[model samples]
Target chain A: MLRTVLTAAIALAPMAASAAEVVSAVLRIERERPAPISRLELPAGDEGFMGALLATRDNETTGGFLGHTYVLHKAAALPEDATAALDDLIEQGARFIVTLAEADDLLALADHAAGRDVLLLNVSAPDDRLRGVDCRANVLHATPSRRMLADGLAQYLLWKRWDRWALVHGSHPRDREKAEALRAAARRFGARIVSELAFEDTGGARRSDTGHVLVQRQIPGLMQGLREHDVVVVADESQVFGVHMPYRGWTARPVAGDAGLRATAWHPAHEGFGATQLQRRFEALAGRRMTDLDYEAWVALRAVSEAVTRTDTADLATVLAHLLSDDFELAAFKGMPLSFRPWSRQLRQAVILGDGFTVVSISPQEEFLHQRTRLDTLGVDEAESACPL
Target chain B: MRGFLAGAVALLALGPVAAWAQVVFVTNEKGNSVTRIDVATLEVIDTVPVGQRPRGITISNDGRQLFVAASDDDTVQVFDPETMRLIHTLPSGPDPEQFVLHPSGNPLFIANEDDNLVTVVDVVTRRALAEIPVGIEPEGMGISPDGRVLVNTSETTNMAHFIDTETFKIFHNTLVDSRPRVAEFTRDGSLLFVSAEIGGTVSVIDPASGEIVHTIRFAVPGVTPEALQPVGVRVTADGSRVFVALGPANRVAVVDGRTFEVKNYLLVGQRVWQLAFTPDERYLFTTNGNSNDVSVIDVAAERVIKSIPVGDQPWGVVVSPN
Candidate 1:
């Protein structure tokens, strides 16, 4: 299944001598192993952290002209000095850093890497300030914004006529911001928030004894008889009480948001449309499985690889220039061709909708017409984004 | 002159009558049913109820008995060609999805999906003689013409496991891309064509060495790569053209047998899973499970000449005897 084109990039013609020299771009990713964001469980079969890096690298390096390679530095959150380690990685010839970390942590790292000409990519963060008024010039994002995920979920809800929603939010800045996005989507799609309830994550021992009974009482009590709304949207990103909201704990009405209906980056059933081959290849190389982090790594690598394949050399400037140009076509195993947003350098792609084991649909949806592609409808359009650089 | 006229008349009377060549049988998966139709008349002649989820089907070499692998029932339901009755049942391996008959008409080779094994059964006794372990989710089964090797394609591990029929040992494990569902060896035993449903391409691999030499990519807009997948494949009698049933693409893609290059698409019914040809190689038939219809294609014309209505959710289909 492994098909290598084996391009002879070193033996090119003499006309391109004045052009940018081929510099090997190394991207070092610092993150947790087997990280779970929303519903994408990593290091499983098909896709995982390192596997994703290679997929993107392989895709971008297809023509072999671009000399960008992603080197992943994965470690658990408890054991390592993430910031110093990233600095050490940069000293070791890596000029780009992609991190799957807390919003504050990533911002600190980005600020530390500032003035050094090193770009820091925040793969998964819901911090509004990143894309809002406080966006950075060198920092890029591969994960869909919280607003985008909410809108992606709400489009289908709007389509299904589940207009009346009882909003339940967890106690977190990110969770509240996500709720704001949901509220905005609700307003835009003609949905009504009948009531708002806050579920504070009071950390205690694993609530195995009285958890189910307590959840049953609190959830049903908050909703008050179940007919008040068509859907109960829970915004709990901390994994606190999200799983307990379905079936017996919550209102009999169908659950949306974090647990019941989730929007994610990848799933196991995405094998159709030649995804399986990429997944299989990655799995074969990496003994452990792939995750969403792997996918982010993959996209980053692919971006560079694509530039090399399309342009003259594996030069950093040419690769960057090609990526910034509109003619760039990157295939990142999402069953479609993808392009980046000009303003924020955010990659526009489809968000997968899931309910436990079954994959429901991909959002931005097939019908979200935006003239050329429906994938354009997934994230912030160029006109709406505030990032000037 | 009177004696010569009498001899010519005797010779004319001695010739055999032409056998029927326009019939196709479709097996319904959920309905546990088999529908027989006259290809020329475009009519359902009979519908016989069989066992659970009848998937793999093949006609006996003599064309008298139709063998259907009833997976849930753990047996191959044998039907009488003329009456369309449940004549008998052949004991198959655990969870059979596909089966192939020996060239000598003595044994039946079956690919058991759940067990990851291929069972060789004695045709006369309807008993499994040997069960050889292959790979994960072994679905498609086919035998080489010279009766030397039996091939099984596994879905999960993405490999085609070739078994030496005499020793019943897995001699070669050819790693394909991903989710390889079906396999068929060329008539001359030179090439083994395996279709990967997930890979969305048919790989032409060497059966002896388990090396892939050629891969054909199938693509069309408005259709997913999953749908453009090559599943059931059949080569022409002359070995010039290969017809691959593109699952859910609603077409049978024709490829040059020698070059392994796709020629054109032959539009068929929806979700076309399996194919069968008549004894004379004049007509080709395919079962479209989703549309619940059987398409009869004129082999020479390369088009769906007629559609025969069949039972619900037809999966495995084959041609019976004259």
Candidate 2:
């Protein structure tokens, strides 16, 4: 259906000879790599890259009326060194670049484009260091940081009066960082971390003929002697063993964090506050449910489009200025006007807490209040941010 | 003094004869019932159980039938107003949230929140006439006084889809604030007001051009912006006053229709969802969802006169025309 509409729109495009200025956006995505676990299904298509394309279409829908047109340039399968890719897009008159890269690569790209007249939007990484000590003036983060996601889940857990948590983590660097975020959230929300355990990632095939029996016995034994806790929090972004801990725990407790009732930027089951429309549009365009990375990429591109349309300027400096100003706010169907925090340049948004099939709740719960904005209560606030910019 | 004495004597002579007995119907979403209130006596006369999750309620053009959108049941239950009994059920689309009747009294436009379609059903035939494809999660429905144009607000899309009544085609889509829940037109049909629940503002749109002319924002002294969610909108018959229900703030903001400035905020019950006016426009009723009651506001006095307890989660309200 979306293809038919686009084809019809293209067929009718030449009839309107209005001289509309064109706004160009470039998306740079990393090449697909094999997952650590063979059991995990790979996404059928590029997640964040497809989201940028759909957002460009959405931008054109409104931009067409404002004497503006949008053009998207896709740079897929880019190598680790994004310098050449950035230079190529910059040479092609692309002022806005949406980067779907890891934290280190994103920082490198940001530094490479620092003195240039371009803005880079980070849409994939959720590293706290990027929003804190290594924050960049030219780079804005659309995805929520690890701390924000942890705080969002912790707020709900506290609201449910589940103050004691049993922390479990995998043997990975990213998992350790995520566990640290959970620890910080526990301290911030007055929750007690009663027990901490680590599961070693033994090198083996994730699935075997008799793996379920081993997992059923091993998971229960791993959690047998834990102290009494209200909830079991797992930090396993590597998808190692968290999936086995949900129904296999010995105490029959609810799981949270990276598994079970998880907090994410977007969920496919979210239909409240008009999110159903977005889900329908995404499915129509991408032929699948939108993932969290897709939503972040859409938000990044939409932020650029919003600034351009509001200011009526394609000038990079002017658009960036408008985006960073206090007056700029983007309505991305999160039930509130989403804006960026000036201190860290992190977009403030509501996080969804879901139980795989349906959305259980949204963060920034009624009890967690902030002086300036309630959304700021979810992540590192301006007062605590280490970024000098 | 002589004029005052004459007015006092006239009031005594008129008595209850001048007061009209109005019936206000409030739909309780969670309780699946409708509470009928007698305006003159200020009492809940009867509570009729209808269907599962009744949200939107309205009266027919002739005032003979009352329509309530039973969202969960996927039907719009029709009731005889005089007898307060279910007469028939119209096949509404899935998850019908709100609906509006055409001024010509033939077709009803219903917003299906889950299906992303607007189901147009014939009132008398009780059959669907047309189902128009709209933006996602269509919730609010408004028809022009002349019935030439119909507007549906999609909550997630944040766009007010202006549908041509004659063609049943979307002529224009105007983007409003976040989570637009209600759309209302002025008496003259020149201006349209869309309340965005999460955007915290009411956008005054120019219906013809599909452009937002002005935005009305509410700011109470102690109320936070997150809690000041604008949901239901009601414009007076004369188009002089516009009332907006602030969802969690528990207040109704009265806006000067012509000047586009907020005049006053009348306190109501918790989590007000929808509003309706009496036939004479003398009083306005608000369904407070959290408090599970209906608040009666004397329009002339601009104050809440009474709070009558009703069913659980009172969502939508409509008064009889006669």
Candidate 3:
């Protein structure tokens, strides 16, 4: 009789099986690059712009605990397919989408993921607009915001007593946003921008075809009438002319912008609390040191793991509620805990100032440090966020 | 006069002239300081600042010099053991992480991780005599009993590369696990132990054949692999007991040397990295790198009888030869 009853129950178990907890994720690599290129110094896929996104998936899921099995789906993106690709990810049962793209791609993904119970995690792109007026509820930024990066630079500048600055801007939207963010931070921290200069896109190689002749022709006049400033802050996020600006075009003063004192989510030498272990593991598995994009994606996956463990469920609503709540704190490789902005849902974090191989310092060196809590210093704080739930 | 000279030599051979094991050298990783402790009175003698990020330390065979590998500075610093003064600095090639002295006391072999090479430095000349390529991320180093072979463990390749000291060539590479950090051979040359920080186990390999003979697994439920990391392992002189330091687990596992079984565990401070033994083998000292304290264990009782606070991030420790 018991066997007959068990067989009947097993036959009627479709509804319960469907309700069993499961989480689906989509890893989207929205990058535009030529065929993968190899520099002699690095590996085959090391130098390509697209490889940064492809390498991100290498850090996603491990240990396989909490009944969570993540599925990653890859999509190659040009500049145009940002919106439709993110929508396709949501339709394919991905409650979370991690993207490696720029400001325009993030804006499109933010709209697509909004109100859909799907979180769009941006691993690349450091435009302040995404964390400011353009911030959204469904979008969760894994990378440190542009404002945080600027703040970090400003703190070091203030510490070094570089109280005067000359701001230079480039043609791209990324450059404009970075300059504006730096300007706002300087205004708040009492560092004055003495002068401003703008560089044309020129549309070709990074270096001037005319070379030193062109730089000698243009820079003296642009910087001719300037007063004594401590440093020159150049915003060339497009990498078009940031390298050219240093030691060649600019004046004799030291530059502290994209080229000299860069602010980013991660650096190889930022050996803080868990960074050594994470970096060691990343190097072991990925066969190379981790970059900023890879680090952000890893943190996004960690946030997912933490939420799943805390909520004890993979259901979209439950996980979203926990992530939005104030009690969430993520212990990342940054040596400090991170949390979310209640309004914008951007994860608050510090940006490390990088000089290529080494990290010079972290922002908010404990003075301009303003926070509703420590996590609020990353992006727009809870009290000031304009994002609507 | 001849009889008096022989008597004085006998007295000198019998013991130290005075009680001179007063200061223990505690190597600091981040603070860049070497703490000195008076073990007899349990007082911190002095915290002397040193070169950047010193990790491993070894007292000279004569006990007159202490060599510390300041990794960040890429040099080995020599200090007067009696005066505690920075007497001399020796270039250890690029990124020297650990060092092991030759038994004959003529040269020092350094494991340079950044260059992936082991540098043999002439003690008197203080110059690198030879550089031999090893595995990737070469860290812990040990010399064989016969002093003819040296073993260096690479963390990334997870292998023990045996270097022939005479030829300065890699004899063999024995793969152990995910991240093998350190390797040490038993005094009798019977067993070689390699610690895999990520693998959560130490592998015992036979030096002659480069074969893993035994695997010792360490684990505690609910604690992650990051916590149960086994870093430093030292065997007693009589080969009766083996002590292994578990990184964040904050405990040292005392294993039965003959049976290869864990006998008991002694709780220590946090993030235990390097450990040492008194020359008499009666007490074991562990440098708790995170807690800034050195835990002194009574080996016979298998308990940490005392904890002495030291410099910031106390890392490596070595007993004085005298």
Best by lDDT: 2
Docking category for candidate 2? incorrect
TM-score of chain B of each: 0.90, 0.93, 0.92
- Output candidate 2 Cα RMSD: 7.1
Which candidate model has the greater lDDT, 1 or 2? 2
Residue A85 lDDT (model 3): 72
Residue B115 shift from truth in candidate 3, angstroms: 21
Give a tens-digit lDDT track for model 1, residues B1-322: 2432443465467654534334577889878888877655667766778899788888877677888889878788888765567888876766677888888887898887655567788889766777776654577887888988888886643557777788787666665655576787777888888886646678988877778999977766666443575789887767787888887788888889888888888888998878887767778888898799888888888888888878988888787666
Give the higher-lDDT candidate: 2 or 3: 2
**Would you give the TM-score of chain B in model 2?**
0.93
Kindly list the per-residue Cα lDDT of model 2 for residues A250-305, writing each as its tens digit: 89899999889999999999976557667777898899889997898889888887
What does the i-RMS of model 3 come to?
25.1
Q: Give Cα distance to truth, residue B7, candidate 3, Å.
A: 20
The candidate with the higher TM-score, 2 or 3, is: 2
Superposition error at B82 for model 3 (Å): 13
lDDT of 3 by residue, B104-127 (tens): 886898888765567788878777
Error of 2 at B160 (Å): 5.7
TM-score, one value per model: 0.61, 0.83, 0.57
Each model's DockQ score? 0.03, 0.15, 0.03
List where candidate 1 sits over 4 angstroms from the true fold.
A1-166, A173-197, A202-230, A239-253, A259-389, B1-23, B45-47, B81-91, B171-174, B188-191, B205-213, B224-226, B306-309
Clashing pairs in 2: A274-B156
